[model samples]
Structure formats: C-alpha cells, structure tokens
Target chain A: MEILETALMQRALIAAVLVGVIAPAVGIYLVQRRQALMGDGIGHVAMTGVGLGFLLSASPVWMATLVAIVGSIAMELIRAYGRTRGDIALAMLFYGGMAGGVLLINLSPTGSNANLSSYLFGSLSTVSEGDLDAIWVLAALVVLVTVGLRRQLFAVSQDEEFARVTGLPVRALNLLVAVTAAVTVTVAMRVVGLLLVSALMVVPVAAAQQITRSFAVTFVLSVVIGTAVTLAGTVTSYYQDVPPGATIVLLAIGVFLVLTVLATPLARRRARALRPERDEHPAAEADGPAVPAMRGPADEARV
Target chain B: MTTTQTESAGQDTNGAKDATTPTVLSLRGATATLGSRPVLRGIDVSLRRGEVVALLGANGSGKSTAVRSVIGQVPLTSGEVTLFGTPLRRFRDWARVGYVPQRTTAASGVPATVREVVSSGRLARTGLLRWPSKADRAAVQRAIDLVGLTDRAKDAVGALSGGQHQRVLIARALAAEPELLIMDEPMAGVDLASQEILAATLRDQVAAGTTVLLVLHELGPLEPLIDRAVVLRDGCVMHDGPPPKAVGQHALPGHDPELLTNQSCHPHAAGEPHRTGLLT
Candidate 1:
C-alpha cells in the first residue's frame, strides 16, 4: 500500500495495465498466424532503435518505435520476397538487430554500457513523466488501429490466401499488422524490456486459447489474464526487491502452467465430444482420398 | 444425377440464355511462374454467367495455378485476366466474388464457431468499421442452413469433421451471396457423404444462377453439375469442351504417349482404379 501511494509506482502500474491490454490484443492475431515469434524479433530489432536514439540525442521510445516499424515492414517484405525460407529471413532480422544495437551502443559516445543495461533489463524507476506520456499515446494508437481493423485482421490471419481472393487488400492489411506489432513491441519495452516483451504478448493469449472457443472471447480473456498477471507481478516485485519485468513474465508463465494443468481434462472432454463419428462411418472415411497418400507422379518421381 | 445432366444440357442450348448472359471470368494467354518453373504457360479459359466450369488436370499440369491466376493469387508474368470485363488490376468489387481455398489441416489455430467463421465471409459485404446489419445476419444464417450445419453453427470449427469443416467453408463462401464462386479442390479430402451435400448445395447455387469455377482432381459427384470442362496438360489447355463422361480415362484429344509413359512411371497416375467409383 505504501508503494502504491508513490507517483512512480502509480505511473508504472498505469503503463503495465496499458501494455497488458494492448500487447495481447495484437498478440491474438500473431498467435493465430503462428507468428508469435515475430514479436520477439521486432523487440530485438527495437534495441537498435533505442541505440540509434541515444546516438541522435532523441527520445529512445519514439526512436525505437520508428525503427521497430521499419524493421517489421522489412521483415514482412523479406518473408514475402526473400529467396530464403521465411523463418530464415526472420532469423536474419532478429540477430542483425541485436548485433547492430550492441555495436551502435559501443560506438556512440552518449551511450554508456552501464546505462544500456537498464534498457536490457527494465528498471521501473526510469518510467519518467515523459515516458508515461509516450507509452499512453503509442498504446492508444496501437489499440485503436487494432480495434479499427479487427475484422480484416481476423480474416487475413485466419486464411491469408482466402483473404486475398476476397479482395481485402491483403498486402496493405499485412503491413498494418506488422506496423501495429512493431509499435506494441516498442511500447511494452519500457516495463518488460526487449528481452521479455514477447512473453507478455504471447503467454496470455496462449492461455486464453486453451479455454476459449471464440476469437472475441479469447481476445477479451487474454487482456484480463495479462492485466492480472502484470499487476500481481508488479506488486510482488516491489515486495521481493526483484526485477518487475522478469517477475511479470514468470507470473504469466505460472498462470499459463496452472491453466494448462486445469485445462487438460476439459480439453480431453472437448476432444472426445468433438471427435468425428469415425466408427459409425468407416466406409465414408475410407472412401475419401487421404491427402498425404494422394501424392501424384511428381512427388513419386522425387522420392 | 440424370435430372442434373438434363437440366445442364437444357441450359446450355437455351439460345435466350446465351444472348442475355455475359462473360463472368476470362483468362487470355495468362502465363505465370513459380520460382523459375512455368506453372501456367499461356492458358486461355473463360466462364459465362451462371456457367459451372471445372478446371481439371493431373497434378503439376497447372489446374490450380490457372484458378489461382484468375483470383490474383498467382502473379501473371504475361497476358491478361479480367473479372466481369474489368481488368484484374482495376477490379475492386470483391464482395461480388467468393473463394474457397483448398482444405488444409493447418486450422488457423484460433478456435472459431461455425457461425463466426461463416460470418467472416460476409466481412467484405459488411464493409469496414460497421457492425453487421440484419440482412447480413440473415444471409449468414441462410448459408449455414444451405450447408445443413445450422445445428452445429455454434460449435467450434476445430471440433468438426473434415467433411463438416469443408461444409463450413462452403457456407462461408455462400454467405457473401456473390455472383461468382471459385473453389480449389473443395472435395479433395472430403468424405463421400460430405461430397454429396456439397453437390446438392452447389446444385442450389447453379439453380440460382451463380457462376462457378472449380479446380478438381476428378469430377466425382460434381460431374453432373458441370456444364463445361477445361483440361490442362503441361501448362497448356489440352481440351475445352463437354465434361468427359468416362470416370478414369484421360480421354482428351491429342493425348501425348510420352506424357502418359512419364506419368505411368509415377505411382499415382490420373486413371487409378480408386478414382472410378467417386465419379461414376
């Protein structure tokens, strides 16, 4: 209660709640697309933006946002157009961003290695008035855009090829999602740091997915789980004298583990209930071509 | 089945229908490449309004690519594609078209009820930043009923069988109420019962005058509904005429012995015994 009275703690709490709401909103689509790791890639790339900001004597949060957006878009392009496999392209951006950040910090006279560690592992003490303002503005942008394009985003994430055929402007929507994800990574970095931002984005959504049947319900539930874990983790960190970022992530993981444990039986029951009537219709099942076994001459020749 | 054939044949010769109908889709010398290999090499195919055409071919013969090119999924390296007389690049009336992709096991990983998935099909028609209207809801319900999945509409699609899942996809496409419906291998992994349901559903669509372009491995239950068949061989249109009546025979004119010999070396040729009963 004493810690809650302080302005710094209150600011941190507000930021945490904001991130908790925004990160997983964006994360649901990322998880749906099986691109959960994309958040991590963008977060790593954001470090370079932070380094660049320090070098340019600018606000690191905004710089990180700019760099993250560019990096994310570039990642989308690379995934689409690169000669290499999609994951390989993402790997390139992930490592390159981290390496570039390290090199830039070392080279910049203003960037002290000592201070850089604070950004690496978040320090709640550093959430100044300006940082809070930036977080709110950026968080609002991300949330609004996500809400505004929810249907299109959902359609694209569900089936990109189908979305394109429907004339949903698939490429533009994809870019919008990439940019939103990048913004989410940058905003979340203030509390969780780049190292653990993706955990906040993915874990809650994953937990929500296990229990919820509909995307809308899953989305709303993820925010609830994320906010609860973040607030509880913040309070625990204050009492235990530990890093809030790591505590928040660990708490999320703890909640996830608990949910998984509880969900096992429920999942089993649901699977049993939903299992197709294979026994009753063995002939029909056997009549349909087994997709894997339907390999044509081209596949056979290759083997 | 005989009734379906007679109806399709009658519709085909109805000179009054030809005079009033317009071309819904046209692919003129469309050429495309996937990674350096030419997948669609100078193909020409067209569909008239309310016509049900099947794009058929052996695997690697460019049937999928041709349909993909029409839908703008495959970038054409040369030639032109037009949707309702509008150039592909300039066409923006997407609500007028519905597409069902080939079924894959990769379920979006996000659990959605059948109703919700079907409703997404109406997104284009619903437009952006607005809640669905009464009409939209009614259309979605109608589509669900069309596919005979009204009872399961609230169930998560992940819980459905492969056949039911395919029906949900078809229902989704139907929700749009588009004039043109294009599907890629809609029955590839679907059970016979599901295929019959799909055939009946498509029969209704044909009766309602919807244009359809389907890519299929074999005609199967859909043979009776098809008014025309376009066969592709090595990225070229080998035949464009009546649907082949023989189930297991690749009986197109100018059959290449070399291609047949090459295809025979591969384990699953086009004329396998298992493919017969599904169609005939």
Candidate 2:
C-alpha cells in the first residue's frame, strides 16, 4: 500500500495495465493470422527508433513508434508483394534495425549500454511523465482500432482471399493491422521492454485458446489473463526486486502450461457429451456402407 | 445507325443464347499465367441466370485457373471478365456473389466456431462497420442449418472431421444468400454424408434460381443438379453442353442397379470406382 502511494509505482502500474490490455488485443489478430513473430520484428525495429531518440535527445517512446510503424508497413508490403523473397526481406529488416540501434546509441553524446538496456528489457521506475502521456494516447488509439473494427479485422485475419471477395478493403485493413501492431510495440516498450513485448502480445492469447472454442471467448479470456499476469508480475517485482518484464512473461507461460493441461480433460468431457449422438446412429460413424435410406430422401428432395 | 451498331456489338459479345436469360458471368479470351506457365490460354466461360454449370477437368487442366480468373483472384494477362453484365474491374456488387475457394479444412490459424466463420459471409450483405442485424443473424443460422451443422454451430471448427469442415465452408458461402455462387472443387474429398447434404443444398439453391459455377473433379452427387458441364482439357473448352454422354449415363437412368447393389463399393456415387467397375 505504501509503494502504491508513490508516484513512480502508480506510473509503473498504469503502464503495466495498459500494456496488458493493448498487447493481447492486437496480438490476438496476429496470432489468428499466424504471424505471432511479427511483434518481435516490430520490437527489433523500434530499437533503431529508440537509438535515434537518444542521438536527437528526444523522447524514445514516440521516436520508436514512428520508426516501428514504417518498418511494419514495409514488412506488410514485402509479405503482400514479395512472396518468394519475403523471409529474406524480413531477416534483413530485423537484423539491420537491431544493428542500427547499437551503432546509433554508441555514437550519441549521452547514450550508453546501460541506458539502452533499460529500453531493451524495460525499466518500470524509468517511466517518465512524458512517456506516460504518450503511452496513454497511443494505448487509446490501439484500443479504438482493435475493438471498433473487430469484425472486419477478424474477417481479414481468418481468410484474406474471402475478405477481399467480401469487398472489405483487405489491403488497407492489412496495413492497418501492421500499423496498429507497431503502435502496440511502442505502447508496451516502457513497461514490457522492446525485446520481450511480443510475449505479452502472443502468450496470453495462446494460453486462453487452450480451453476456448470461439474467437470471442478466446479474446475476452486472453485480455483477462493478460491483465491479471501483468498486475501480479508488477506487484511481485515491486516486492522481490525482479524485472517486471521477465516476471510477467514467465507468468503468462505458466498460465499457458496450466491451461494446456486442463484443456485435455475439458476436451475429453466435450467428446464424451457428443458420444451419445454417435451411438444413436452407429451406421453413420462407419465410413463403409452408404445408408440407402439417406440417399433415397436426398434424391426425392432434389426432384 | 450508331445505336444499332452498339446493340449489335453487345449481341455479338453476349452470343444468341444470352438474350432470354441474362448472363451472370462471362469471360472472353481469359488468358492467365502462373509463374510463366500458361494456366489459362484463351479460355471462355459464360453462365446465365438459374444455370448450374460445372467446370470439369483432369488435374492440371486449368479448370481452377479459369474459375479463379472469373472471380478476379488471378489476373488475366490479356482478356476481359464480366460479372452480371458488368466488367469484373468495375463490378463492385460483391454481395451478389458468394465464393467458396477449394480448401480441405475450414479451420484457420485460430479456433473459430462454425457460427463465427459463417457470420463472415453475411459481411458482404451487411457491409463493413455495421453490426449484424437480427436478419443477418437469422441468415447465418439458416446457412449453418442448410449444411446440416446446426448442432455443431457453437463448436470449434478445428474439432470437426474433414467432411464436416468442408460443410462449414459451404455453410459460410450460403450465409451471403448471393445470387451467384462460385465454388471451386466443392466435392474434392468430402465423405458420402456431407456429399449428400451439399448436393441437397445446391439443389435447393438451384431451385430458387441461384446461378452456380463450380469447378469439380467429378460430378458425383451434384450430377443431378448440373444443367451443363464445361469440360476443360489443358486450358481449352473441350466440351460444353449436356453434362457429357459418358458421364451422364452413370448418374442418370441406366446405372440404378449397379449404384444400389454396390453402394458400399461406390462410396462416392459416380467416382473412379464406379468408372473402373463399369470397365470390369
């Protein structure tokens, strides 16, 4: 309670909660599209932006957001147009961004490995007032896009070709996803760190899906799981002097493992409930003999 | 003289048969290449209202490519496609069209219930950004029921069998209530039960005057609903009328005894086994 009274602790908790919500909200779509590692790429690109911020003596959070957006859009373009050479293009972007950050930070007058390490792995105590304001604005934007356009985003992520045929502006929506994911990376940068932001984005969704049957349930449950783990990890770190980012990610992975173990029994129970219907018609279960009775009505219906 | 000239040009493009029933889709000299290999070489296909046309071919015969070109999925290198009399490039009325691309499973990267996937079909009709109305919900439910997956509507699609997964895909397309349904290989690996349900569903759509263009490996159960069969042999129309005599006989009157007696043997009614059984 005393720690919560401090301005620094309050700032850290607010940032943690926002990261918990926004990361998995955007991450669900990425996981849906099977591009879970896309967050990791954006995180890498944001490092260059952070380094540029140090060199210019500007806010690292906003700078990382700008560069990550450009990098993510480039990744989306390469994915859309350069099918054969996409992986190679992404590899170059990821490594180039990482190398650029190290080079730029060292060249800066005031920057050092210690300063970079805080951004790389996250420093809750270092969340300045300006960073908080930026995070709040950015997080609001992420929430608006992810929640407001859920149906459209769901359609696009589920099947791009079908979404195009539905006249859903699949290309624009895809770019929007890339851009939103980049924004989320910067939003989580201060609390979860640039290097580990992706775990918060992906792990919670993956864990929730272990027992869920539908996307909506998976989404709501993941957000709940994310917020819980983040708050718990932050509090635990406050007490134990552990890194909040590492603690939060470890908690998420722990949740995933527990859910996975629980899912098997849950699934078996579901199968057992469905067994009676199969038992009622044993012939249908057997792939061999075509039930002549079923075919007769089908023909009559056609006539 | 200019008015008559334009009218004659329209007639020339649409052909004489299109006068009675308006063309739902038409492709003229639709040439498409996949990575330098000519997949569609001067292919042409036309479907009129209420027509249930099947595009049939052996593997690599460009049947899939021709349909893909019709839907504007694959760009034509040098040709034109018209959907419901409007050129594909200008045709924005996508709500009138429902597409079911060939896929063995309806399961995506994420676990989605049968209802969730089917609801996406109604998006074309509901438009983007609008919440689904009560009517939209009913339509989605009806589509799931049409494919006989009402019970499984709430269940994850990943848990479904292959045939049931195919049914979910068909159900998704049906939710749009599109005037024109374009399905590529709707019956590739479906089981007998799903095949019957799909056939019945297609039959109902045809009776309601929904124009259909499907790419199929074999007619199988849908043999009865097909009004015309366009056989493609290496990117060219080899035959396009009356469901081809050799294939039609197996499905129509002459093969009832063999079909009934060897029902187990002919699991896929008019499949390869039936053809081989005929020769034996």
Candidate 3:
C-alpha cells in the first residue's frame, strides 16, 4: 500500500504511460519497414549513454538519447552501404554499442556502486516527476513529427522506391525514421529498459497489422494495445512485487501470442462478414503477386 | 514546370486530330555505370508530346535506367535530358513530370486504397506544408475514375490483383495532372484482361493530352496503346521511330557497328534495344 502511495511509483507509472504513446505511434512505420531491429540497435546504444552518464554523474536520459540519435544514424548509414542487410547492420551496432558502453563506463568508473542491472532490466520505482515531465516533452515531439508527416511517412512506408520517384525527399524521410526510432528508444528506456524496448514498439504494431489492412486500424489498435499493456503491467508489477519493465514486456509477449492464435479465425470471420465485397477466395488469390518477368519486347511506342 | 517549350507543344497537339508536337523528352550521349559496370552508353532518344513512347530493351538493356534518368532518378554520366524544351535541371519540382516507378510490387503493397494511391500523385504538386486542395481531390477522383477503379476506391491496394495494382499506379500518375506521365513496365505480371484495361486507360490519358512514357517488354500486349518506340542499348539510343521499324540490325551511331553483337562481354555495348531481355 505504501508503494502505491509513494511519490516515485506514481511518477514512474505516469512516465511509462507517457512513453507508451510513442511506441504504437512510431511503431506504425518501424514495424512495417521491418526495422524492429533498429529499435533494438537504438536501445543498445542508449545503454552506452546511460553508462557514460553514470560515469560522468550526469542525467542518464539526456546522454542516452544523444548516443541513441548517433546510433540510429549509424544504423541507417551502414544499412545503406552495399549488400549489407539491415538486420546484420543493426546487430553490429547492437553488440558494438553494448561493448562501447561497457568500455566507456569502465574507463571513467566514477560510480562503481551504480547498479547497471536495474538500468538494463528497468526500475519502475526510479522515475521522478521531473523524469515524467521530460518523457512527456519527448512524447509530444514524437506526436508532432508523426502527425505533420504521417501522409508522407505512410506513402514512403508503403513504397519507398515509388515514394522517391514521386519526388518525396526520401533521404529526409529516412533520417526522420532514424530520429523517431532514437526518440522512442530513449524515452522507452525508462519503462521497458534497454533489452526489451524494441518489443514494446514492434509487437503491438505487428499485432495490429494482422487484424486489419487499414492503416488507420493498425495505428489505432497499436496505441490501444500499448496503453493497455503499459497500464496493466505497471499495476500487476506493483501488486506482484516484481520488476516493472520485465513484467510489462512479458505481458506484451503473452498478448502477442494470444493475438497470433486468435488472428486467423478473427480475420476469416471479418472477411466472411463482408462476403459480397470479398468474393470467396478471390481476395486470397490476389494477395501476393509473384515477381513477374517482363513481357516480350513489343512494338508499342511510348504513349 | 516553367519550361518555355510547353505552350508550343500544347498548341501543336491541339492543332490537329491527335496531332503531336515536337519531342519534349530528349536524351543524348547518355551513359550509366552501376557499381563499376557499364549499363548504358551514348544513348540518344527523344519523346514527343502526345506520344505514348514505349522504351523497349532486353532485360539489362537499361530501359528502366533510361526512363529513371529521364525523370532525374538516375544521373547521366555524360548526357542531357531535356524537358518541355529546356534542360531538366532548370525545373524545380518537375511538376509536369509524373513518374510510376519500376517497383510495382512495392507500389501495390502499401496498405492503402486505390484512391489514396492516386492522391499520392498529387503530393509532389502539393509540396510539404499543404494538404490536397479541393482541386487536388477532384483530380484524384477523376484519375481514379479514368482508371475504372472507382468501384474499388476504398479497397486496400494490397488486396488488388496484378492488373488492378498497375491501374492504381497509372491512376496515381494521372492524379498529378502532368503533361508527361512516366510509368515503368505497367504491363508486367498482369493478366490479359488487366493488360487490356491498362492499355485502354493509357489510351484515355494520351487522348486527354497526357504524354505517356513507359518501359515495356512485350510489344504485343501494349500494341494498341503505344504511339512510338525508342530502343536503348548500352545507355545509347539504337532506334527511334515506330515500333516495327525500331527493331532491326542497325546499331547506334558513333559506336563500332560490331557493338551490336549478342555477347555478355559487352552488356552495355551499343545495339538495338530489341536484344531480348537480359536473360543471358
């Protein structure tokens, strides 16, 4: 009861909810672009910032977000280099950032007593009102960028090549993606910690995608799931006397597993509900187009 | 969009029954090298207003690259691409140049409706800070109607079939209300009926004063739609005329006559664009 009454727990809960807003909002692009690993990379890099802050005795969120932005840019730049796949590049940064953080911390070693386990694993009892205020500010920035550029982001996410041809500033859009990832990972670092932050962004959005083809639905459902998980996990962790971030991530995983099991039937029912629009199996047949070769060179002139 | 040559072309097209003015799209001495490999060489071709020009090239013939270069996606190694009567660099947004990229699958996979896809075409003209105007909305509706996708306006593009998706892209290009519409391989992977639908839509756009430029493989499917053919080989123009005459043993000028040999040793070796797909 005292824990519930404590000022710190209330602040942490507030912070978690505030940060939760970012996951589903930004996750719309991150999940679809299959850049779930980008969040993972950003999280690892955020850890380095946390370690650096501990060594220098500065604020962790500030330092973590700075490293996170750099790491996000690095991830994008490396992924664009040659045939290096995005996942491979992310993993490189993920491990490299972790190593770099450890090295930086060891070198400075200002606070040998600072327990990194809580930072890596997360601590709901640690958030201050000031921390929550800062999280809200970051969350608001994310909301603005997402709303202002949602259309372009949607168009780009759907087809980056087509987006480029249509004169979208694809390079700028790519940079925005990295920026959003950095922001989300940094804020989320407090709620879900470094290890499971990507899951908070990706899982709910992916679950939302499976339920509907509408971009709006995917987005809305992700927010609902994110909010729900953040709330439920915080309450449950408070009552159960466990680590908040780990419990919340595990709860999210459970939700994902259940959603996956329920998806096919729900999808079929929804499709069947609109039977006239979806003619039997026609929609299914039309789903995936094979990589078709060009038709024979024709005599057709450019019209 | 401020090019000095467009009014002349417009007046010329309006003069007769579907009379085309002079060429607005012209590429000369074009060369492309990707990853240290030559893809195009010394290309020279021009597309006239009211002309539905089919870019025919065997696979690896650099047809897509040629089209991409025309719209400024691919930079020329040593060539000039003129739009409306001036150089491409002079234009700001190239608002008059609408493009449907070669990545059709990517275009169609976006979780949007046909109408939304068409609305994206207006985005270039809309720029960043502004939403689509009523005029833009009407144009989108018109483009969707033109593509005969009004029935499926609300359906997810991902739910569309091969041919329907192509129509969606074409409708998107049309929404820009551009004079020059560049679509890459609009006919690939589509069913016969869908191809027929696309061909009909292309004809409509052309009739409505839009110059259609596309990369095409099978001439037979698009025979009814194309107005002329331009062949590219090794980044150079091989033939420029009607499709039937475009195919022949004649090679591009300024290159060795033997550059037309069917050897992979010189993939970009100048020759006719009809060297078949780069299946080799």
Over A87-176, each residue of candidate 2 has an lDDT whose tens digit, in order, gives 999999999999999989999999998999998899998888988998889899999999988888999999888888887888999999
The regions of model 1 sitting more than 4 angstroms off are A270-303, B1-20, B249-280
- Report the poorest 10 consecutive residues by lDDT, candidate 3 chain B: B245-254
> Which lDDT tens digits does candidate 3 get at residues B49-163?
7777778766677898888888777787887888888887775555687787654455322255677667877777786668878998999999898878887887777877888
Judging by DockQ, tell me the better candidate of 1 and 3. 1
RMSD of 2: 8.8
Question: What are the lDDT figures for the candidates, one per model?
Answer: 0.83, 0.84, 0.73
Once superposed on the true structure, which residue ranges of model 3 sit more than 4 Å away at CA? A1-5, A81-90, A112-114, A273-278, A281-303, B1-23, B103-110, B245-280
Window of ten residues with lowest summed lDDT in model 2 chain A: A294-303
Q: What's the ranking of the predictions by DockQ, best on top? A: 1, 2, 3
Task: Give the range where candidate 2 chain B is weakest over 10 consecutive residues by summed lDDT.
Answer: B258-267
Give the Cα error of residue A42 in candidate 3, in Å.
0.9
Tell me each candidate's RMSD, in Å, in order. 7.1, 8.8, 6.6
For candidate 2, state the interface root-mean-square deviation in angstroms to 1 decimal.
0.8
